[model samples]
Target: MRRMTPARRILLLVAACVFLACTAVPAWRGAKIAYHLHTARYLLGQGELAQALSWLAYPLQEQPRSAEVHYLLGNTYRRQGNFDRALRHLAKARQYGWRREEVDLQVVLIDVQRGDVEAADPLLDRAAVHAVPDDVAVEVYEALAKGYLALHRIEDAMVVLDTWIQWQPRAVQPRLWRARIHERENDWDRAAAEYRQILSVKPDDVPALLGMAGALLARNEPVQALPYFRRCTELAPDPTQAQLGLAQCLRRLGRGAEAGQLIARLLRGSLTLEQQATAHYELGLLALADHRLHAAIRHLQTAVDLAPQHIALRDALAEALEKAGKSRQAASHRQQAERLRQQEDRISRLLAALAESPHNPDLRCDAGDALMQGGYPREAVRWYMNALKIDPEHRRAHESLARYYEAIDMPDLAAEHRQHATQAGAQPQLSKPDQPDGLRGDGPPPTPKACGPVQDQPPLQKLEQRAGPP
Candidate 1:
């Protein structure tokens, strides 16, 4: 109990100080980590992604083993659009045995954003195969579906989306994805059904409403789709696309003035060059539908000027100019279109002539090509039929007829052709006359003269009816 030796006292003092320092170190580090984590989260909430990233960096350095820090950092990076860094941190989070499913999903999403779908495929596969929680499993499936969609593997996307929907019927995402896939496949009825299912689940879902409107418009059911389009307009943040879609639906439903007003509003907004051109083009078409040729010409000309590369807009402008009696401008556009059309026609005719010879099974399919190129799609049906008649198993002909019928709004006929094509083991064919040579050569020739608008027939005269009326 008396005074200790100097060396012993020094050693004892150092030992006590060391114990205190060791104890304080963890608390200090823990506090620092907590503070940084909270600050990072706050910055993220405020959308200050860069600031959040800086805050997350310190915590990550201090607690290199911390999974939560890695995950938060990944999220911050993702928000900042630094997909590579986001992926690196997310992968680390998974490696550290963090929320494996959530980190895996972030990795998949980043891969998709970076267009590394092939890389994402294995991660998605692993996530699906693993014993993940239900909510996490749904997320993995959704991510896989999105990955497939990004790669344009639509059927694959549908398979994933359908699986998710079966597991969670109440989930709107799966239905929304299913609708998107259907829309891409031009299966408007199926797309509309899926969209309706989403709406039933989430009545206020703007995307579902917009999708429903689009599907209805595609099916020529604009009248029925109007309410959904209006709802989409009401719920959308910017409401530009919804408003544009509404305008289209209204125009299709013969509500020209209402459509015009919506188009006018869209035009007044700060739109991208492409959007501006599209808006002008749509307004022109609306004007044309209303028989306001001068106004149509004005909007169409502006559209053409804005987007000279848009062949459809240019063609529309020419048509409007012709209706407005601007013969010179119309003639110029017609000349351009004719030049392009002639180039296509030459190839089609050559193919047709070769096919007409009957010697080359490949060339015989050309008759469909010629019919389509010559703007005699209805006649193209005959050529395709004749080709199929010669080679009862001609796949190209069936595929072509299916596409032509679809274009002409004859879904039943199109389905029949598609069935025949599928039976013949042929790929789907496009309705365009200038399709790839592979499409013409590989499958049955397309239907001949299948898509032209029907001319209104003259009213029948009834002498007996006239006498009765008198």
Candidate 2:
């Protein structure tokens, strides 16, 4: 090759710089966006949702049309209970060429939460089963069960769990959840039956042992409970609860001294507030049985102090106080107990109202408030989210959620909802890419429509295609 002149060499250097600016600079920026997306995914998996969203912010700003970015954002919002934003981003992801099967499944899951079972049924068919991963299938069924449970549709929850059990016979979680539902309904026989089935497979499962023992104890069959409780204490990761259950069984079986000793040991160990309260209550009951009136009053009073909302604790204290001739204090406790019962009754009535009118945003908000007052903040969250599902800009629901997030130390979520609460007529809109329009923040809130047209096939039959009878 011929040697270049100085002027030509300078020109060539300039051209090379232009070429690098044209190709390499954009490539570097793209790489940085991809790195942010990857970090967001990792943070999401780690349950650091706030950190994940922060990491996603940069990529979302830089690559507004990126399918992967929107998809990740969608999932993060889904986990955060911001289903409206989640659906919007998921729609954007689908519009930008993300996998349709996954996007549609997510949409169906949201519909399920909206109590739109018909919309979910078509997508849950066995023919489409191979398109969804096993984990996704599990999520779908779990969402169905949880949604129905939240709506107090216990029968539907049972049907879903039964179908899940049929599909995954060996799954421990489903069986455990089913047992819990049974326990909730006071069906001790059925609850014990479920636990027995679980123990038949995983004989040493600590939860199963404890659950079986608990069911028998609830049925006042402590003789039958004793062996399971003993086994549980031996195998449990934390034996405190199991030992407590054993003490309860011992007390019920007329072994008060043994129960007292076990309870004393339990009190010496570290425990959650609720567990501590339970221990004190059991100790008080044992003392009362032995006619140690003063000791019974002390222990029961401590339990009531620890768990003031416990109706049983309040009742026991009232009884002890009345026996001790403190009629005034006993009357006060009885009145407090009545108030607690009324609060619980109000919550149940609100939930029943919600079940009858699932789309009523005001009813959902009221239910959430009632549940919060009744000492169930976690369950209250579902109602608040349901209210938001119906009316995204609902002031009371947003304010309640903001308070909840603040209490939980999730400042980002708290602030976001606070902002949403203040935004009177608008939502945060996504900038349009080159594709068709996704959900618009400025558009009117979705109409409060009933769950889609009912399927001709029965609920269980909708999921039974290709699978054997449920």
Candidate 3:
């Protein structure tokens, strides 16, 4: 490496500066986005989510069609726990043709939290198929499984659980739930197997132990159940529950005296209202088996009193009274249970109102979500578009439209609308995030197509790929 002369060095330096000057516009534009990213990250690190908004704002107005800007916006809102805003920006990021898997997972999480599991399923499925990180994939599956369980969609819950178990073989919660679901479905052998698998790993897991014991009792193998019930009692912090299980097993085995002692002790312990009712109900059952008619009637009455809303408790009390020759009281208890059942389902009422308000943008957005969940993308798109026709800035509908467009192979349109959604959200104004209304409204209305009326029209050809948000 020979040292260059001063004249030669000066000429080379000039050449380098000239080259940089020639590329100045693109460099400045790239630097602008880089500055936003670096500043946003620093603010985020300092727990100043609000402060970070201004940094991204400049870039967003400059590159409304930029997937990266919307992506930053989505994550910023996500950290703020503003799922609605987060989802809106995430959708734009996806539409801009970036990180569809990552964005879908976020959408699924938001939908699950909103109790719209139906809206989350397809996106969750897509995320599961993609190569997302293990933690996100697990969260996606668990959220869907738990959501389906809450809605009484048992089979759907099981399907997700199966996949979740496959992916996270060491996850204890899913396996426990899988076993519990099996128990509910009366698949005793499968239930036992799953519980045993959990026990195999976490030998002292109390829930699995209790569940396994209960399953054995359901199979009428009291002899097998007796030991497990005893072990659970030994492991339990509140051994009062163990006492009740022991009593049940002893009574089943025809050991009346020992079972009666256990039940009596259980009734004297500190217990929840439900537990008090359970203890009384079991004593009533054992007393009836021993032909103590008056004792059975008294205990059954106490159980019914403690748990007036429990149909089974009411039924058991009614039966004990009938056996004790009090048919009138049994009929009254039945009538009370009937009245409780007769109360209206409030969910049905909200659903009815939603059904009737088909044109309401919020309702239409919900309808669109449901349609999307049910695998009707085109119809969902129509509803989402219609929703925007009513309110162009409706964040969810725009986000949903971006998803629809992406699913149908229209990446360019997806990115455009997704970017549109970022601007459409309810983010706080931080240092003039956008240009004045004059510039914001520069784009013309796009032609209405299958996606419905345009919310923000397609930007002009020149602006579509501009440095700022179009």
lDDT at position 198, candidate 3:
88
Q: Which candidate number has the best TM-score? A: 2
Rank order (by TM-score, best first) = 2, 1, 3
Please write out the lDDT profile of model 1 over residues 1-470, one tens digit for every residue. 78899999999999999999999999998998899899988766544567787888788788898888888888777645577788788888888888776776676666554324345545544533344444344434544565544333344455556555655677787787778766755789998899888878878877788888888888888788888878877877668887787888877777878888888888877887877887888899988887889888889888878876566887998888887778898889878777667756665465435423432334545755765765667656755765554455678888888888889899999998888878778544333332323445654532211001112211111111111000
Runs of candidate 3 with Cα error greater than 4 angstroms are 1-114, 118-132, 309-311, 334-470
lDDT of 3 by residue, 1-470 (tens): 99999999999999999998889978898898888888987765544577798788889887899887887788678655577889889988998997876676566666564335546545534433344444454555556665555434455566666655654576677888899888766798899898889889878777788888888888888899888888888887667766777777888899988988877777777788988888888888888888788998898889988886677777777788888889998899988766544422322343344433422466667767765654457766766776665466777888988888898899999998898789877565333212223443557422111110112322111111212221
Give the Å error, residue 456, model 2: 23
Residue range with the least summed lDDT across 10 consecutive positions in model 1: 461-470
Report model 2's TM-score to 2 decimal places.
0.63
TM-score of each: 0.52, 0.63, 0.48
The model with the greater TM-score, 2 or 3, is 2
Clash counts for the predictions, in order: 24, 0, 12
Question: Which tens-of-lDDT digit does each residue in 247-304 have in candidate 2?
Answer: 9988888888998998898888898999999999999998887778899999999999
lDDT of each: 0.67, 0.77, 0.69
At residue 462, candidate 1 shows an lDDT of: 11
Residue pairs in collision within model 2: none
